[model samples]
Target: MLCQDSAFRLYLDRCRRHKFGLTEAQLPDGTHNEQDARDWICAACSIESRAELDHNLEAWQTFRAIRNRFNRWRARGGA
Candidate 1:
């Protein structure tokens, strides 16, 4: 996933702020194409219920944690 992408980053920020409205389950699955990243942002922008917001936050948290770890590893030359 392109976490650095503006749209994707916005989605992540929205999720962090506890906003969510996506109907489809678009949680990260270790691999994401550009379309998947765009879909995630679209979902964030369309969130319409408390349940979906909560789900988004949960998924985003997990995704962020994993991404952070990967970034740290890469920084340490794990790439």
Candidate 2:
């Protein structure tokens, strides 16, 4: 699943740190953990869960768009 992918998880961490400007101390529990990333992904994609990306075409497309944007940012050395 997308949520279980190591690379994607790392990207999420970077996104929170760089793109979102969120530090661990700034998070609710002083941690930018897996659940936080999953929550962010769900919120960003307007889906209830990461599993939805597998069966929901719209959610998958939205996730892809997000990933593409993140990749572009990374390519430009934004992370």
Candidate 3:
């Protein structure tokens, strides 16, 4: 999973390089989310998804993998 994070971070880094950077966007629900940011991150880079910008599956998978790794590492150290 760490390998995946490294890969994704590298991807997102490329995204960051492509986009000026991820920026917050207001959703239809009227809450600010990373939708626009992720959209820019992908549309300007790799792995486009048809999911709602905020709920984009590609982003979710990347986030989930990173979070899971963090949680597992935290558990090991009683953090």
Q: What is the C-alpha lDDT of each candidate?
A: 0.49, 0.71, 0.45
Clashes of each: 2, 0, 0
lDDT of 1 by residue, 1-79 (tens): 3544544444444343444554324443234455655565445446443245356876566556656755665576544
For all predicted structures, in order, the TM-scores are 0.34, 0.59, 0.32
Q: Over the full model, what C-alpha lDDT does candidate 2 score relative to the true structure?
A: 0.71
Worst 10 residues of 3 by lDDT: 24-33
Off by over 4 Å in 1: 3-55
Q: In model 2, how large is the Cα lDDT of residue 79?
A: 44
Ranking by TM-score: 2, 1, 3
The pairs that clash in candidate 1 are 21-47, 21-48
Error of 1 at 68 (Å): 0.3
Q: Note each model's CA RMSD in angstroms.
A: 12.2, 4.2, 11.6
Judging by TM-score against the true structure, name the best candidate. 2
lDDT of 2 by residue, 1-79 (tens): 5555555566676656666677755642324456766887899889997889889998889889988876776687654
**Candidate 2, clashing residue pairs?**
none
